[model samples]
Target: MTDTPHTGGCRCGAVRFSAAAAPHHVSYCHCVDCRRASGAPVSAFVGFAADSVSFEGEAPRRHENGPVARSFCASCGSPIAYADSRLAADIWIMLGAMDQPAAYKPTHHAWVREQLPYVHMPDSLPRHVKSSVPRPTE
Candidate 1:
């Protein structure tokens, strides 16, 4: 987090956005949904106050999967973010989209039970079979 804002956009440059404040929480999700959505072993994201983020150009293409709604770039099919409609005020931006991904630090590993055995867990993070506490902020 810095006085300077964080900014990023879709790979095709069809979509652009900015965040005025540092992200609140960052994490790597190993849930099946995230794995399928990202086409990777895990999906890394940075959570920000919804009001602090803004978008430009084309809005992300959205997909509803159970309780989660994911956004992606239509042009490049890049995973953008996941917004839980239930918590309309928060947005989880994909870490890969950040211009400064090193600034993103994952706090926890979610859905540990479903994580691939080959995927090693960092002892530093608190691993949970699922979110132990209800994420009111989503």
Candidate 2:
């Protein structure tokens, strides 16, 4: 909401990052990849332009799976971020890691096909079958 840069770090404080601009999007993802990466039924992320974000403190441990690169706090094992090569212009940070988690509220659901049957979200947002990113016209 405010222009003050959004900041956050890992649970152990070994990894810190700052997002200088407002998040472009915030959403929950139910894809299997997200479930595995986050160790939760679903994952929430706040996205910012790649150029506006920077990382500091201890170097993060990274895992590469297909097009997605996930980073975790090397010291505490807290999930740091999710970056997908297909969406090179943006980087998604774990919503749980934000300093002010309530400031950025998720607006949609993604990867609904992989959503667990028991998970029920408020029926106010659009749900995407896969990614919300619009694919390029062929």
Candidate 3:
């Protein structure tokens, strides 16, 4: 990964952020909660050390959803990041919110049990029936 800092924000530019380090992992999530929150069949995210990320402008509003604290832009309601107590050391940023989203790529699919029937993915990558932190080894 490039040493260049990764930067991005919400749709309205009211919530901006920068990450000091490149993501440790990136993946597509097919969990029901993620699908509903993102209004898509799946959502992609980048994992980073919790302390590596910092917010600028208006901070994202946090919504407590079970064990995960989902953050979104209060001004435009754009999904931002998620923090789970189970994975307290890391913060997962929604890939779509990144300024250069193509810089990252999904390494696997998580929560495949909830994946929509029509959603097709390559069988070569690792897939988990439920949320997989640290990823599920083959």
Question: Which structure among the candidates has the greatest TM-score?
Answer: 2
Q: What digit string (tens of lDDT, one per residue) describes model 1 on residues 33-78? A: 8899999998888888899999999988999976789999999998
lDDT, model 2, position 91 = 93
Across residues 60-89, which tens digit of lDDT does each residue of candidate 3 receive? 999997668999999999999989877788
Candidate 2, residue 74: the lDDT equals: 85
The digit string of per-residue lDDT tens for model 2 on 1-138 reads: 565459999999999999888999899999998898889999999999999999998988999987779999989999989988878899999999999998888999999999999999867899999887664433
lDDT scores of the candidates, listed in order? 0.84, 0.90, 0.89
Q: For candidate 1, what is the TM-score?
A: 0.90
lDDT of 3: 0.89
Score candidate 2 by lDDT.
0.90
In what order do the candidates fall by TM-score, top score first? 2, 3, 1
Segments in model 3 whose C-alpha atoms lie over 4 Å from true places = 134-138
Model 1 bad stretches (over 4 Å): 136-138
Best by lDDT: 2
Pick the winner on TM-score between candidates 2 and 3. 2
